[model samples]
Target: MKNEGMERLGKDELSAKDSYYINVMRGLSILRVVLVHLGLSWFYPPYSQYIGIFLPVLFFVSGAVSYYSFLRAQSVGEYLVKRLVLVLVPFYVFAALVLLITVVFYPERFPSGIGVVSWLLVWPNFSDVFFPLNQVWFINCLVVMILISGPIFFITKKRPWLLWGVIIFSLVVSLLNVPFPLYAAVSEYSFFSRLRWGHQAWQVLVLLGLFICGSVHYRYLAGQSAKKYALISIVFLIFALMGYFYSDLGFELKEHAKQRSLYYLFLSFFAIYFLLALERPILRILARMRSLEWLLLYTNRYAYSVYLSHTLVLFYVEQWLGLTDLGGQPFLALVRMFLVLVITLAVAKPLGDLSRTLAHTVRAKLLNGIIGGVRT
Candidate 1:
C-alpha cells in the first residue's frame, strides 16, 4: 500500500452510489459475455464485435475498484483473501455441480485422465483442460490480477516511472503482431495452443497494464467532469470508426480482438472512457425507472455467479434437449441463447441471495480460515 497521504484522496474515493454506476457497466459486460459464450454464428456479423471491449471494460473497472479496496484494506493478506474468496468459492461450487451432472448424467462427455483434472482445478480455461467451463478463464485472470495488484499498487504509488515503463511494455505486447505464445510448446491439437502465454507472457501483460490504468483512474481521476472523459472518448471513437469503415486502416476492434492488436487497444480505451462519461446520465435514467433499475441492479449484484455458471447451464440444457446450432441458423441460436439466459438467471438469483447471507454471517471466519489466519 502507499502512504496515507496518497491513500486518502478527498472526494475521489468511489462512494456506494458512485459504484452503482460501475455495477451498471458490470451488468452489461457480463450479459454480453454470456451472449458471446452462447456460440452465436459468425453470420451474425459484428455480433462478436460488440463483445470485444467488455472484457477490457471488466479489467478496467476492476483495476479502479482495486485501488479503492487496496487503500481501505487493513492488511495485504486480507485484501487478497477477500477477492480470492469472492471468485474461487462460487467457482468451486459451480465446478463440483458441473462435474456431478456431467459424470452422473452424461458420462460420455466426462473427461478422462487425472492430469486434465489437475489443470481444471488450477487453470480451468478450456476443453484442453476442462469442458464447457471455458468461461472460467476470466475468473482465473482476475485471480492473477489480484495476486499481483498489490505490488502494482505499490509500484504505481512509489515508483510510478517504473509502473509507466511496464505499462508501455505491456501495451506493446498487446499491440504486437506476434502469435500467442506456447503455441509451439504444446501440441497444436491441444487446448494449450490457444493459451495466451506463460504466467508472465502474452495477454497477461496487456491485462495488467489495463488493471493499472484503472487504479490510476481511481487515484487521480475519479471525480472529473463528464465532459472531459466524453471528449477523450470521442477521439478514440473517431479512430475506431475509421478502422471500421476503411478496411485499409486495419483499425477494427472486432478484427483485432482475438489477436489483441493495436486497433483493439484503442477501442478498449474508447470504451472505458465512453462509459465513464455516460455514467451520470445512465444513473439518472435508472433512478426514474424503478423496475428497470431493480432489474439492472439485480443483474449486477448476481453477475459474478451468473457469469461463471451460465456456460454450464447452457451446455447441460443443450445436452438434455438434444439442441445443436442446427445449420448455424440465427433463429435457433437466439432461441437457445434465450433459454439458457432465462434458466441461468432463475438459478443464480437465489444462489446469490444465499451467498450474500453467508457473507454477512460467517464469511469472515470462512475466508480467514482459507487464507491461513488472515483477518478481513
Candidate 2:
C-alpha cells in the first residue's frame, strides 16, 4: 500500500546521506543490467567487460543494507521471516506470472509440469524453467547470502579476526577448482544441490566475500575524511584499470564469463571502492541537474521491480519484433533498449506495488500471530 519499491533502504535503516549515493549507484547498476541484457554489449564490445562491476556492486550494497537491518532486528527468527517475505514473494509472484504468460502464448518454451513443480518449489532442476527467470538468480542468491549474514554477524560481533578468516576461506575456496568427482556427484542431485555446491557454489563464495567487504566498509570506512576517500579512490582506480587491461588482454579468459576467483573479485572491489570514493563528486555533478536527479531517484526507488521484470519485457520485445537480427545496428540496438526500458517500467510498477503490499501484509499477520500466541 505504501508503494515504495522493495524498500531497498528505508529511513529507519539508513540515513539520508548514506542512502542517496546508494540509490544513485543502484539505479545505475540496474540500468546497466537491463542494457547489457538487451545486447547493448554486442554493439560495443568493451561494454561487456566494463559492466562486470555492476553485480558485485549490487551484492556489496545488499550486504551493507542487510547488515544494518540485522543490527536493528529484535530476533533472528523475526529477521529471517521478514527477509524471506520481502525477497522471495516478489520473485515468486513475478516468476509465476512470467511462467503463466509463457505457457499461454509460448507454451513450447515452457517447461513440463514436473519442471514447473520443481520451479515452484524453488528446486533447481537443470531445465528450461529457469530460463525466463534468469535474472532472478540474484534474488535467489541474495536470500541465501542474507540468511548466512545473520549468523556471521552474531558470531563475529566481537571477533573481527574471525570475519576476516571466513572471508579468506571463502576466497580460497572460490579460487580452487572443485574436484571432478564432487562436481559430478552434485550435478545429478537437484537444483538445490547445484546451488549449494556445484558450479554456482563458487559464485556464492565470492558473493559472500564481497558482502562481508561491504559490511566492513559500511561499519568502519563510510565516514572517513575526504583525503582518505581520495587516496582510496586512487588506489581502487589503479587496480580497476589494471584489471580492465588484464581482462582485455585475455590473461583471465574466464573472468568475463564465469567470474569465479579473486582476480575478478578484485576488479569488482576496485570499481565499488572507486564509486564510493567518488560519491561526493558524483553528487555534486548530479546536483546541477534537477530533472536528472529526480529521474535517478525514481529509478533507484523502483530498481528492484525494474531488475526483476526487465528481462521478460526484453524477451517479449525481441520475439515480437525479431530484434535478434538487429544486433550490429547501433541505432536499432539503442532504440530496442529504450523500448524495453519503457515497457519494463510500465509492467514493473504495478507488480512492485503488489509485491510490497503483499509482503507488508504477510509480515503484519505473522508478527501479530506470534504476539497473540505469546499473549495467550
Candidate 3:
C-alpha cells in the first residue's frame, strides 16, 4: 500500500512538470485561430473543423490554468489583480501602439471619440471601432470569465450541488440550441444568435462548460497516464460523433465555427484528451529537439499578444497581397501565412514583453503595496 501511494505521488510530480504542455496547446490554438482568420475555414473544409476546436481548447485550458492560480493566491484581490494584469496590460499597450500608428500613418483612418475610448475597454465585437482588433473578442470574453470565476470556483469547492445546478442550466442552454450567441456577440452573421447582449448574460453552455471541464480536469484528471487519457478521449469522440449527426450539437454549418453547440464541447473534450494522451511521445520528441521546444515555448510566450494582434497583421498582409484569389493561388496562401506569422511575431513580441514588465511593476508597486498596507 505504501509503495502504491508513493507511485501515485510520483506520477503527480511528473504531471506538474509536464504542465508546460498547456503552453503547447496555447501556441497551436493561436496558430489555428490565425488560420481560421486567413480563410482556411472557408476554403479548406476537411480539417478545419478538427482544428477549429481551438477556441474550446483555449477556454478549457484557461480554466485549468486559472485553477492553479486560484490555488496559489493569498486572497481574492491578489487573484483578480493577477488575472487583470495577465490579460489587460499587454492589450492596453498593444491598443495604444496601434492607435499611435494609425494616427501617424493613417490619419484619415484615425479613431474618433468613441473609438478612442473603446481602446480602454475590451468588447467582443469592436470591428466598427477598429476592424483589426475584432479578434480581441476572445480577450473580452476571458476578462469577464476571469471576473466571475472566483465565486464559481468557491461553489465547486464548497457547494457541489449548486455547481451542478449551474452546469445543468448551462448545458440546457447549449442543448436548446438557443439563438442567443455568446462569443460572437449579437453580430448579424453569427450562427443563429439574434438576441442582443447574450454574450453577457447567457453563456451558450459551451463557453462555461469548457471552463468547468477544464477546472474539473485540473482537480481530478491532471496526472493520468497516456493510456488513461486516450481512453477518456475515445469516450468523448464517440459522444461527439453521435451528438453531431443526431442533434446538430457540434458545428453550426460544419464550415465556420463562429457558433458552437453542445456537440462542439464533446469534440473539444476529445481533442484535449488526445493532446493529453500525447504526453509521453511529445516529451520524447521535444527532448531530442531542444530548438523545437524553444520555439514552442516562444510561440506560447506571446500567444496572447498574437491573438490580440495577429488579425491586424493579417489585414495588412492581405492588403499587400492585393487580396488576391488565395484559394486558387496556393503559393500566395503560403506567403500570406508566412508574412502574417512573421510580421505578427515581430510586432507582438515587444508588446508582450512590455505588458509583462508593466504587469510586474503594477504587482509590486500597486497590488503588493496595497496588500501590505492593509496588513500593516
Candidate 4:
C-alpha cells in the first residue's frame, strides 16, 4: 500500500502517461548500462570505438526526469539532499570501499586505480578508479547540471526564448572556445590539469543543451506515434552504426557528443512510440500475471544499486579468473566477459535489494514525519 505512492503521484502530480514513460526510460537506461559494459568485448570494430555513446544520453534523460521531480518537490534544498542520499552517498561510500580493497587487500591494483587522481580533481577522463561508483560520473554530472540550471530554469519557466538563448550561447561558446568565467579555476588542487574540455565551462554548455531539450519535451511534446518513433529510432541506430565504423570521429568526442545526443533523441522517441503501440496488449499481459509486475518493479527499484556495485564484482572476477595473467584473446575474452556478467548479476542482486529496502524504509519514515507533525 505504501508503494501506491507512485500510483498517486501518477494520478495527482504528473499525467499517468508521462509517469509511465519516465519509468520505462529509467528501466531502459539501466538495461543499456548493463549492455554497454557487458557487450564491450563483443562489439565490432567501429561500434567498439563508439561503444559508450549511451552514457551522456543517460544524463540528459536524468536531467529531464529530475527536472520534473524538482517541479513536484518541496524545495531545492530538500530535493538536492534527497538526491544526494539516493545518488552521491552510495557512490562515494562504494568508491571508498573499493579504494580500500585495492589499496589494502590487493596492493598491485592500487596504482592502477589511484591513477585516476586527475579525473577526480582536474577534469574528467576515462579512469577506472573505484569503477563502480566512479563510473557514475554521468549521474554526478546530471546532479551538478540540475543545480546550476535551477536559476535559469526558474527564470525561463514560461519564457521559451530565454531558455533557447542560453542553450545557443553555450553552444556557440563551445565552438568559439571563448573562455567564459563559467569554468572553475581550482589550479591549487593536487591533480589539476590543462584539459580544455570537461572543465566547468565546457560541461555547462553540454548540460545546458540537455536541460533545454528535456524542458522542450516536457512542455510541448505529446509523445510520439509508435511506428513513427520506431522509424526515427532505426535511423539513429543506423547513424550510430555508421559513426562507429565509418565516421572519423574519435572515441571520446563521439561518446560525449554524437553518440549521446543522437541516442537520447532516438531512444526517447522509440520508447514512447513502442509503449503507445503496445499499451493495451502490454497492460493486458501484466494484468494476466500480476507477479510479473512485482518482479519488474523490484528489479527497477534496485537498478541503481546494482549499477553502483557491479564493477567490484567484475574486478573480483578478473582476480579470481587470473585474467590479469592471461593474454587477451578473442575466445578467452568472450569467456571472461560472460563469467563476469554472471557473477556481477549474482552479487549485485542481493546487495541491490538490501539497498533498495533501506532506501524505501528511510523514504517512508521521512514521508510519515512530513505528513504527521514531528513529535517531541
Ranking by lDDT: 3, 2, 1, 4
Candidate 2 overall Cα lDDT vs. reference?
Answer: 0.68
Residue-level lDDT of model 3, residues 238-326, one tens digit each, is: 98777577564344445224455556667777888998898779889999999878766777898888887888878777776686567
| TM values, all candidates | 0.79, 0.83, 0.84, 0.64
Give the per-residue lDDT digits (tens) of candidate 2, residues 1-376: 1233224323235657877788888887787888778775555555555566556788887777777776677666666767677877777677678688768876777877776765664543545643455666676678778788878877876664476776676656544433233323433457746344354544666568887877676665666655676677567667555555544536432444465444566667777877777888888989998777776676676777888788778777888887767755878887888899889878877888888898899988987776677679
Q: Write the per-residue lDDT of candidate 4 for residues 141-199, one digit (tens) a residue.
A: 56567676666656765564476676566445433332332233332233434443334
Q: Could you tell me the lDDT of residue 201 within candidate 1?
A: 38
Per-residue accuracy of model 1 over 1-376 as CA lDDT, tens digit each: 2343354455436767558777888887777788777764244455545556757888887877776776666566666766666666666656666667767876766656763464455464355323466566567778788888876665555554465565576666644434443312322434545453343234565667777777666655666678988988889778766544433335334546554555566678788998889888888888898877876677788977788778778877888777776555768777888899889889998777766665544558855575665423
For model 1, the stretches where C-alpha displacement exceeds 4 angstroms are 1-13, 39-43, 46-48, 108-122, 128-131, 158-166, 175-200, 238-255, 320-323, 326-334, 354-363, 366-376
Show how many residue pairs clash in every candidate, following the order shown. 0, 1, 1, 0
Which ranking of candidates, highest TM-score first? 3, 2, 1, 4
Give stretches of model 2 more than 4 Å off. Answer: 1-13, 46-48, 108-114, 121-132, 175-197, 233-249, 252-259, 371-376
Which regions of candidate 4 fall more than 4 Å away from where they truly are? 1-12, 48-51, 99-104, 107-134, 158-201, 227-299, 323-335, 353-376
Q: Which pairs of residues collide in model 2?
A: 124-191
